[model samples]
Target: MASASTANRWLRPEVYPLFAAVGVAVGICGFQLVRNICINPEVRVSKEGRSAGVLENYAEGEKYAEHGLRKFLRTRAPEIMPSINRFFADPK
Candidate 1:
């Protein structure tokens, strides 16, 4: 059989990437959970007397409301494109 140190050396590098991937996945999941909780739609409806769900109740004479992400993107696209273009431009 191979020596213990030799076996460990072979195993460590293989395991390190797996551990790093798992850590990144866990961090992403945690961030998503917190974001969803913070943007809870129920709280907005209860406090503002408006439907905060994805679909608005336009049939009941309430104004239609776009999703927060869409609204932000639409309003900020002009401002965001310049920054994105600058980041991708040639450094020379």
Candidate 2:
């Protein structure tokens, strides 16, 4: 057993160069990951209303954000239903 252990002694952790090379490779990969993330821009959205309406990139405000907004009613789902206690407006 002693002879076998002595033969495998080269695999001992006293090998500093192997460990140093592995550490340097990991450190370089980590640095590259951080550098790539920092170089990318973060996405930001500006909301101007309560609807889940997606804003048009060129329009700054909610009203003009969606195309054909002049034709569509821009009310929430609850408001679209008639009020039970009050006179309802014509659906048209």
Candidate 3:
């Protein structure tokens, strides 16, 4: 059988990317879960006063109905590499 030192070798630098990928995936899922529970009008449940249907809160829900990032980016153009594009486009 292999020694304990050899077993510990499994945690090498090569595994860092996999770890980062998993961390990002977990973080994204967690963020979506929290956003849905807190900001999503349809998924959210209110404990204040009488609970209303999704349609009842239409005007009030309009604020958080769309994701903040999405709303902000909606009016912006997509830029893959703004710096690089600017550098090449410069006349200087």
Candidate 4:
């Protein structure tokens, strides 16, 4: 048996951040697992398809392993705060 205060301690505002952090971590891990299962050639389940050569498999693995978002961003500037970056980068 536990006291009401002891049970209520877990619901305090101070515990909310920990809960949020855990939720985010779980979500990220789940997404990665699903992505790998779906696209990572080594882990992806193959159906009846045309047999591929070794070179083709390697090329496909590289393409499928890269997330679409990462591929899209690869050509773009890595800027978290674009406005601030431009302001600081500009010569007076």
In model 2, the Cα lDDT at residue 52 comes to 47
Least accurate 10 contiguous residues by lDDT in model 1: 56-65
Model 1, span 9-86: residue lDDT tens: 757877888889989999999987785556644334254445444545355322223556667788764654786787
Error of 2 at 4 (Å): 15
Q: What residue pairs are clashing in model 2?
A: none
Q: Largest TM-score belongs to which candidate?
A: 4
Clashes of each: 0, 0, 0, 0
Q: Provide the global lDDT of candidate 4 against the true structure.
A: 0.79
For model 2 the TM-score comes to 0.31
> How far is each candidate from the true structure, as Cα RMSD in Å?
8.9, 21.6, 3.8, 4.0
Candidate models: Cα lDDT each? 0.63, 0.56, 0.77, 0.79
Report the candidate with higher TM-score, 2 versus 3.
3
- The predicted structure with the larger TM-score, 1 or 2, is 1
Estimate TM-scores for all models: 0.36, 0.31, 0.64, 0.71
lDDT of 2 by residue, 1-92 (tens): 99888868756778778878998999999986785454322222334342546445443344333436344555534454457424655453
> What shift in Å separates residue 68 of candidate 1 from its native position after superposition?
9.3
Top candidate by lDDT: 4
For model 3, residues 17-79, the per-residue Cα lDDT tens digits are: 998999999999999899878767677465653355446777667877665788989987798
> Candidate 4, which ten residues in sequence have the lowest lDDT sum?
47-56
